[model samples]
Target: MEVIRNLVQSLVIIIILAMFLEMLLPAGQMRAYVKMVMGLLVIIAVIQAVGSMARWSFEEIPALVAGTGDGGGQLPEILEAGKRISARQQELGIEQYRQGLAQQVTALVKLNQGLPLLDVEVSVESDSGSPDFGQVKEIILTVSDNPKQTSPAPGGTEPVEEVSPVTVQIGSSETPEREEAVPPQAAAGIVDVLTNFYNIQPEQVIIIYR
Candidate 1:
């Protein structure tokens, strides 16, 4: 009877102290996390107190953890923590894998015309599979060129060069297609170069000038 009373007193004292200390800290996600930890601590303390009184053996712990025994109270919180950790790890792994593929594509693209591959977007066909290069469904490359040698106009002012962003779609259809939207100040030179060099139709080429 005295042990039970002492346990109750201790719990009340801990709660009062926590409440007083918590107010000294700014509230938000940090406060929420603090509360969760405190709750877990309370659960642990109660479980230990009860197990000691009942003379629980170590062998009973697995049954308790699986929620098959009467002492399975903490299993829900443990499962919740496991789920959150697993989800975050999966998110980080997928993003890292995608970035690695993009970097490899960028290096390979730089070999063509010595121009920069501004960005590469890749799509995978399979909804379920171990991530690998073979699952790639299509790749879109935003190709751009290096600055060229320019001369001043006869009037002593240099002509502004127009930006033509060529969007290339690869492996998306029966034949890979290219499209370029013409800017108001159209720079047909790059579009012409891509179309003629690649032996593709002019319409397959799109020119976006900026």
Candidate 2:
């Protein structure tokens, strides 16, 4: 009972003293600092009073209040962790956006049933600070020519053709083999559709035939 009474009296005295000091201080940044300090002092007093009542030693109270323990040392680690989390989230968002864009491209290309679309690849800018961040950089479409095949007569299987390998001379003058080119007329519709719908250039949409 006596300890409680004394604690109450001490708190009242500290509040009254803080009010008096606040009145004497000028209205400026320093006054705000003083008020903060006074508030800390009041908190310390309450903790001390409680510690005494509980018969607990508060020898490290000052260090804890000053943030000189593990709290201060872990500040940089906490900030680094936050940055890593933010970067991972950005990467996930970019991946999801790329996947969704690829699906849309596939759907648009499929609208032209003449072209057989094998796969769709979408490229996007990953730099968050760039002006074109998250924008589609390019679209690559893999397509195949629908070759016509004659059905076997009745139940007879088709005969397979033999492919003979030719020997190459080491010093012979020969032209290098090139990839099969897709006709412009064949891919022009796809390019126009993508360019007009995505607001991208015709060159940005590449078509590869297999």
Candidate 3:
């Protein structure tokens, strides 16, 4: 009903504008056709407008007076639909986060496997219904640059030294050891990289056993 009313209103305005144009145009057969269409549109518009006014519901009177969208009670339905869409988007985001965490753990394992352990430190705690494994990890890899080689700079000064990349290896231990040792460090590193690189603190990242 509102659609019909708006359509009629738009048509009436278009016809009125077209009629004014016709009057300004030079008298010709084209003017005559334009005048005829304008008159027909005006009549149709008036009839539809009248029908819409007669069929208007009492509940719409407040909205019509307030000049809100559609002058109807459909706003609630639209708002509900928007809420559903928002909830669906949140669900998709959580699923994507889980998948990303799983991928990060897989990559970390592949990167650290079969490497020698320079220093070993072990800590263990059982889960207490929390998302985390209740273990904390902190490790610092000391890297050094070789002093034997020095390259000249453009200004006849010595070039800055470059530090060698350090590789961290976690040995293939028993399931219990791996489960206890690998999770804390790997999870901490994953969170650090994600937060520092992308500026997002993940809710939780679980390390899965292969």
Weakest lDDT window of 10 consecutive positions for candidate 3: 114-123
- lDDT-superior candidate, 1 or 2: 2
lDDT of 3: 0.48
Ranking under TM-score, best-scoring first?
A: 2, 1, 3
Q: Each model's TM-score? A: 0.33, 0.49, 0.27
Cα RMSDs, all models: 19.8, 17.1, 17.3
lDDT per residue, candidate 1, 86-124, as tens digits?
667776766676666656655544443333334566544
Score candidate 2 by lDDT.
0.73
User: Least accurate stretch of 10 residues (summed lDDT) in model 1?
Assistant: 145-154
| Order of candidate numbers by lDDT, starting with the best | 2, 1, 3
Among all windows of ten consecutive residues in candidate 2, which has the lowest summed lDDT? 145-154
In candidate 1, how many clashes are counted? 7
> Regarding lDDT, does 1 or 3 come out ahead?
1
Predicted candidate 3: what Cα RMSD to the true structure? 17.3
Best by TM-score: 2
lDDT of 2 by residue, 63-130 (tens): 34444553343546555656777898999999999999998987786676346566789999999999
lDDT by residue (1-210, candidate 3, tens digit) is 666668677767866776676678657777777777767877777777666666665456545544454666476665665666666776666556545554453344336441112212222222335465433222222111222223242367654555545555689554432113333454456556544543444533232222
Q: In candidate 1, residue 75 scores what lDDT?
A: 61
